[model samples]
Target: MIQIPSKIQKIIGNEKYIIDNVGMSGSSVYVFEDKVLKIQAAGSESENEYLMMKWLQGKLLIPEVLAYEKDDSKSYLLMSRISGAMACDDYYMKAPELLTDLLAKAIHMLWEVDISDCPSIINLDKKLEMARYNVEHDLVDMENVQPDTFGGDGFKNPKELLEWLIENRPEEDLVLSHGDLCLPNIFFMGKDVSGFIDLGKICIADRYQDIALCYRSLSNNFKGIYGRAACEGLDTDKFFEKLDVKPDWKKIRYYILLDELF
Candidate 1:
């Protein structure tokens, strides 16, 4: 059976109950009466999340941290309840037509956030080094790592792919990137996106890093939502074209593979 932290239970105090497990990591996220209490697995991720929430307080649509604590066995964060409509799941099921515009707006919002004041957020070079380390240490599952949309045979050598990425990386735009931007991370009410969540990976990076992942996610999850014939009608081809670069499939695959371990 899963254990709820005593401190977290105490904080919620008599609030009517429900517990929804939201993430796959070691952290345990429980949604009780709309509020969330996340208990990080001992030494894993509590500090980074605490700091991210502190820096992101008023700037983004994120849960406010109410309390934080760490003991020898675990660390926990109590946060304000997030009450909103569903995410991309219901949105695509109900009104698939709006996916394009919603995604466009999400991209715009990601690009617009100011990172000038963010401290301790990892920069692109560091992120690249981390990725390189993962590749070098055989941490990535190369066999299963392939582009989801534009299907390609898995790369024979991750080091070769990493070298290519390092040699031809796009000039960095240094925008604030969601780092893990995908449909599930976005919350929507009607066609408008209400907010974004799962902010632990937020960082400053090249604009292409964000765009590449977004493009791959949309292509993978909702390929049939917008039929091929509607390419012109939906104006999606134009939107993707304006992203101004082809996704480096190997690098995107490498990053996705690395994400699975983290």
Candidate 2:
């Protein structure tokens, strides 16, 4: 049970905040009535998300950063919660067609943003270098990665996969990307996209960086990869149709494999 720093709580005002434990591993998040407080080990991506949220304010529907405090060993960020449930919630999952349509729209929305002065550079080289650092430092959590990433059928280890990625770089199709465009990170309001959360990796990069991860998210959520019951009549082809793009399996696989390192 992590406690919010007293000095920081004074700024946000004392309101008995209820804890909302959500999101993926690596950070502890507490949700108040109107805000979310995320705390992580110091020198993590909290600063990146805070700055990126500020930069994306006018461009997209995202959470507003209320306050940020960092010490030598921890980072705390308080932000306003975006309205609406996760796009992958049971209600949205039941309406697979509408959810697919909204997801396509979300991808297009990101592509349409102006990136002439974007601050984050999430190009392949930059991302691959980070992957390399993780591999060399033994930082990757091997147990929870995609089942296929390591085994008799797949590459021997992260180093082997990194080598393959370096040798097989694809031609760049530049677009603004929500670097972690998984299902939970996106929120929905009715039939439209409400906002996106967990924006630490938001940057200008290949469109497939987003498309690949999002495709994987949909497959897992609808096809029962994450332990929830699979939704019937939910085919990814409908997603590709809504997205107005042909499937590029090679690029999609490449990006997904790259993500395993992180």
Candidate 3:
């Protein structure tokens, strides 16, 4: 067990803690009664996540950062828990329509946040540079990636995908993006969006950044890919209709493919 620093230990005093092994943030989440303590490697994204959460305190529904500490080997961030269930809960999975509606509103909420004074800006050019670096350094994680992303139907490998993305980059429709907008990272209270979690990637980026990931997540979730309700033929158009934007499949595909590198 990783030792919780004294500051975070103080907040978690005598409170029974539960391990939260959800989401793909690569962090250890210790859930308490009304707080969450996330422990991750020192140089990982947790520090930036703390900064982003603090900066977004009033603009969006996000966890309130209470304490942050970093040592040579690990970083600890303690925050007030938001009241809600994950958007990927079994309840939402059974109702794809309502799920889509809430997710659409969540995307809109991210866009509506003022980026004039935003803390992070992860534009495509910067992302592409990082993609190239990841490829050169063999940093891409092959597991948990879209299976088709590299098989016979898709690109030959990560390098090919990165090259294709660079050549076919789409027009920018910038917004305050929830860098990783998968269902598990979004929360809801009833039918309303409650808060966002795993905000390490939150930044100013293309609007399609959120849309593409959410679309793929919805499609997979409804198809029982996560082993729940296998609702075939999910009419994903309802999502775009709710978003008030015509489906831009090209941009969507580009963004989805671009995400593979990260």
Candidate 4:
């Protein structure tokens, strides 16, 4: 059974809240009618999230931090909920043209953010360092990784993959990036982006950092990796088309493989 943290319980105080168990990892999230509570292990990213969300107050359609508290072990953040369904929800997924168009808009919107005073820097070196730490700590979930990333036909192990990433780093495009632009992290309301969630990794970094993950997410969602078949008219190539760029297969592959370490 899931346990609601005492801090969160006190904050909601006699109000009803629902614990979301699906797809949760390393953190616990509770949803009230008007607000959301996220509890996570106190870590560098936790601190990053608090500051980033607070900093992004009027810059974007994102959650507004109402309260935050950090103790020795856990950190809790309470924020307003963006009203909408997930972009990857069946209703949206079945409408590929709309989904693709909105995703394109989101990509462009992220690029438009002024990075002059961006608080976090998720450059390649920093990400590589994080990959190394996760590798060293055995924090990577190998089972959840791409099927071809391990076993007989793929890279032997995380160490080997890390070495490859180091040797083949791509040139940075330095833009404000979501760091993880997967569909579920995005919310949509009537063909417009409502907000972005999971801001811990938002930073100034290569644009492809967001692109690669987002593309993979699109493909996976269409391919039924999320447990449903591709909705009609789902065209994976439309992502790049909507973004107004040709696909850079090598860069995409590199970024996706690099994500395996985390």
Best by lDDT: 4
Can you tell me which runs of candidate 1 are displaced by over 4 Å?
Answer: 1-5, 14-26, 42-45, 72-74, 141-144, 147-153, 224-235, 238-262
Per-residue lDDT of model 1, residues 1-262, tens digit only: 2455676667777776565554545567677776777776655246767787788787777778888887788777788776555444643534545776676677777777788877655665676687688777887664434444122554446665566556655455678777777666677766577777666677777666666666656655545432222221234465464544455566565455434323
85-152: candidate 4 lDDT, tens digit per residue = 88899988888999999999988889888989988898999999999999989888987898899879
lDDT of 2 by residue, 1-262 (tens): 4566776687657666666555666787777777888888766366678777888888988888888888788888888887788988999899989999999999999998998988777788888989999999998879768887887899999999999999999988988888899999999988789899888788899989999999999888888877688887677898999999998999999999999998
Per-residue lDDT for 1-262 in model 3, tens only?
4677797787778888899988665889988889988888776366668778889999999999999998888888888897889988888877777888899899999989889988788899988998899899998888868879998898999999998998998878789998889888999999899999988888899999999999999888877786576765457888899998898999888888888888
Candidate 4, residue 206: the lDDT equals: 90
Q: Candidate order by TM-score, highest to lowest? A: 3, 4, 2, 1
Instruction: Name the regions of candidate 4 deviating beyond 4 angstroms.
Output: 1-11
What are the Cα lDDT values of the candidates? 0.63, 0.85, 0.86, 0.86
RMSD vs true structure, all candidates? 4.8, 1.6, 1.4, 1.9
Clashes of 4: 0
Worst 10-residue lDDT window, candidate 2:
14-23
Please state the error at residue 209 of candidate 4 in Å.
Answer: 0.5
Whose lDDT is higher: candidate 1's or candidate 4's? 4
Which is the better candidate, 3 or 4, if ranked by lDDT? 4
Model 4 lDDT on a 0 to 1 scale: 0.86
What RMSD does model 1 have?
A: 4.8
Each prediction's TM-score against the native?
0.76, 0.94, 0.95, 0.94
